[model samples]
Target: MKLKTLILAITFLATFNLFAQNTYVFLGSYNRDKTAEAIQVYQLDTLKGKLSKVTSAKDIINPSYLTLSPNGKYLYACTDTKTPNAGSVSSFEFNPENKSLTFLNKQSSGGENPVYVSIHKSGKWLVNANYTEGSVSVHPLLENGKIDSLAQNFQYMDGSTNKERQTRSHVHSAVFSPQNDYLFLPDLGVDKIRCYQFDENKKQPLVETKSPFTKTDLEAGPRHFTFHPNQKFGYCIEEMAGAISVYQYENGTLNKIQRIYTHPDKIKSGFESSDIHISPDGKFLYATNRGKENNIAIFSIDENGLLKNIGYQSTLGKHPRIFAIDESGKFLIATNVLTGNVVVFKRDQKTGMLKKTENKVKMENVSCVQIKRI
Candidate 1:
């Protein structure tokens, strides 16, 4: 009887490995006209690399960035962007059963050009980074998937060395640390990453950490950040420098470890690093280059969390702004903002390479892409 039970368990494990999980892809775009399908949802056929349109939410102006709640029930996006003093974060209720996103409500983003949004792992806290005005907005999340009014707006006062770009604070992204006990705001205008301790129980959850911020190289212009799966290392992609800064992450502190260029040629002219993400298995890191390069730089992570440049994959589209790897690490989808093309690529798990597949779709101003397994 023991032999039979052992064989049954082995058989079950093999069956599970043969089937991948159901994946849903979420897309956000720039809709300055407030029409033409601003946000969309698609179901990914993992085996074939096919993307089927599930739903589209329209009339939300400039839903350029998006984040999902921890529970996967709430979807939030930056709306009314690029307009002075009118930016807002809108919320939607995601119905996985029907693959639909129902519009919920919106709250003021507290500044202009709200470009990025991030939510805490607990699903109780949400934050937005206003780019043009250089501020951070904090909001509370209700149990019913509604976003509460703005609780705090932290504004930056100074800039960095670049006269053309850094004359004023431009907060590009707000991301929570791996442990969710800290929040980090990357200031492109200041060339510094501001840190703050967070306590969800407090009326205002964001407060200055012992180390208030980490200064990046002058004119680095940090845009996006991501943490490793082991929770011991973090990466910040600097737009202006076209490089990534590695850090040793502990508690609320980040100690710089190494800086590496994303491109091999070290070209100076027209390249901006836009987004960064680690594979679900933490074996590889990828960053999108938006300007003239328009490619995704791939790096292999060592045992100690240092990165070694491995290869570069052309996005097969122009202005590759954001790309997301599926939870299975078998598929990667990249969105090109200028060409409005969303291309799907099959990922080689062993070598960390991406090959373009025939599966592709076009949406006007498609700027962000995210994939999650359900």
Candidate 2:
């Protein structure tokens, strides 16, 4: 009887693995003219790196940025006008089986144009960064994955040297540390990363850490940040200067170690760098450059967290605003807003490079791409 029971367990595990075949990729769009759905879902073929359209969430105006809950059962998005003093954050309950989203609730993002949202690893708190107003807000999550009332809000008043783009503070992204003990808010207009100690237990959850902030190069316009999986280093992609700043992170403090340019010296146009991400294995880093060089810049990370530029790949579309790699690192999807299409790329895991795939889908005003293994 014991032998029979062991065989049954092994058979069940094998069946489960066989049926888990696809991953869900969510694409968020700006929906400027309301002609396109705000959020579109697709099923990624794990083996072939192909994509098929799933259902989409409509009537969501300008859902520019999206974040999934830690459990993957919910999704949160920041929506509204890019102009100052308007916008909201919305929540949705996600169904893993059918890959569908049910709208849950929304709340004022506390400022204008909330461009980014991040959930705490503890699954109890949600944070948002408002770009136009240069502010941040914290909110609580309900038991059912719905967002509750706002908890705290803070605004930054300072600006940097760039008169055209840096006339005022512009908070672009807020990312929590690997341990969930700290939060980093990268301000594009001010050229600094605001460090905060995050404690969900307190009435005021986000407080200034021992090191309140770290200044990047003047006019750098730090836009997005990604932490190394090793938890020892972090990278901030600068928008205006088209550079990546590497830092050593320890207990909410950041020590700048290296800075690398994303574009070649000859290709000098107005800078419009967008996103940054590191591979799951912590071996490679990727940054997106938009202005004249519409490409994804690739870099290799060394043992000491320094970066070496490998090369750049054209996105094949205009304004590759955001892109995401699958968990298996087999494919990448780039959402190009100006071209109104999504492009798929096959990734060479051995050399950390990308090859354009034949697959392309037309989507209106695509802004962000996020992938989750189902």
Candidate 3:
């Protein structure tokens, strides 16, 4: 009787371990001119950092960026359309069991060339940024996780000192604060991080915050924003300047703390900073630099929200448009657009270093990657 009881306990533990090892990684691509699917699903072996193709969603034109719902049951993408100066957003119900997607609905993104999409923590709002037309839109989320019509949209008219790149306001990323009380829109063309008050209780959910906006350096085009888990600090990567600005965040206000260069030695040209992400443990930060340098810069965050440059990891491909660390922080995947491949790297938890793995998957014109455990 004792031996039989022990055998039953061991079998249950093995089953649970197997179930926990499976993770879903969704890759979004610039499929406008490529034959690859718009969204491809892969089953990631977290322990070994291996990816196996699961399924895909095709015919989506330029799903450049994607965001999973808070519950991981729905997925949203910025459908960067072929229409001149206009684009839209799409919502899909994600089936984790089968690793498939069901198209729910689509709506105009309220501007042109939508580049980024982020869902609110409360699952009540979906916000997107349009790069070409310099606008951001906020759409409401329905009970079924479908996106409703645009609730509020704002256009920025300011431009920075760079004549070529900053000719018009170009909203690059729309990210919410950790507390979900504020929305930060990093405008690459205007060199300003626009802050807005977000109230999900209201029909028009987004409004200008008390301070309105904060300015970056004259030509420092802020492209993306990420908040520390503590909610006390924020970071924005400058696209044109190739630098990261650290800010002290409190109640919709951003106080610039420090601005550091992403490269070892700055180049006169060819610096287009792409994405920024913080580790789940809130101990390290990573930012990508495109153009001449195809690498991800790593930094260690101190207790005072200051950053110390650690090292850089080669992305192994050209134009690493977007990269994401898994929920467990054990794996990092970089989607290279020019090389048409996604490279997975194993992360060192203690030192926050990334070691390249042998796993590489080919997806034509891949632009974005998002991973979650389900």
Candidate 4:
């Protein structure tokens, strides 16, 4: 009996050590031209805060945003961004051993300037939102990670109070609810959150729920959203208003609970909040403010699922567009698009603060970053 117990202990320790050692970083950028490589993979040195380039995938233009499959075997990205009538979503087969991405297939995004792509939890469906054209496209995923033809497309025709920025529908992101039964789309032009019930068993998976959409503050221009780890709360960053709108989530509905501005008042950057994320432990939240603010707004989550502004940390560059926290919540990396720099930060678990490190990488027009441990 003692020998068997000793063997079980050894197996647990081995698994823990293996998990602690493997971390990979994926970055997407805007290509100067079609010949430039746009998607890159790097081996992240967690201890030394270094990024070692592994391989880069080419032949696709402006692969700006990226996401991985549930099993981490595949990667998908929005291609040809800012190119009129040429937007697409492409898939790649990722091999962890060789640390390479093999091009697979791509499907038209149904609209121009496709910005964000997300896969359903079941891994059977993939959806993308077009920013400039105000449209959403859905494609069925084949078993081998190849993207099939476009299935359904929805074009939104609406606008909000801001005449210059919100004169037409601009869908910024498509986020699936924690339950995977609903999809919440933050439309910057319309100033609303459109909700759709997803039935994966049917050919037409996206249908409007009883509550079709929720209205945001008149000129908020809701851009990106995230749900709390506990699944009881939701938060969205308003790009135009420069604030976060908090909501209570249930089934497929969002009830507004609180709203808070992310940055200090009267800054020169004027309020260009970009990305929002909650720590893995659910204790803290972080957001990036662009337009010369170049800082991350830090907040602590209370038990009641509300936020209290703790402090702000400089991203060490300008135009901090998108930032991501690793699954372990030990590190955060922010990408400054205009500055052509990606800066790393170590997170303090107890204080919920970020300290910048010297580990930085130079890449022009770096738009997005994601970290995952394999």
Q: What number of clashing residue pairs does each candidate have, in the order they appear?
A: 0, 0, 0, 0
Tell me how candidate 3 scores on lDDT: 0.89
Q: Which ranges of candidate 4 are over 4 A from the true structure? A: 2-17
Off by over 4 Å in 3: 1-21, 33-36, 81-83
Please say which candidate is ahead in lDDT: 1 or 2.
1
Q: Rate the local accuracy (lDDT) of all candidates.
A: 0.90, 0.88, 0.89, 0.90
What is the C-alpha lDDT profile of model 2 across 58-120, one tens digit per residue? Answer: 766899899898777888999884745678899998886765788999999989999999999
Better of 2 and 4 by lDDT: 4
Ranking by lDDT: 4, 1, 3, 2
Residue-level lDDT of model 4, residues 151-215, one tens digit each, is 89999888988889998999999999998989999999999999899999888899977898999
User: What lDDT, from 0 to 1, does candidate 4 have?
Assistant: 0.90
State, as a TM-score between 0 and 1, how close model 2 is to the true structure.
0.95
TM-score ranking from best to worst? Answer: 4, 2, 1, 3
All candidates: TM-score: 0.94, 0.95, 0.93, 0.96
Residues 240-337 of candidate 3 have per-residue lDDT tens digits of: 88899999988999999999988778566776888899999999999998888899999999999999999999999999889999989999999899
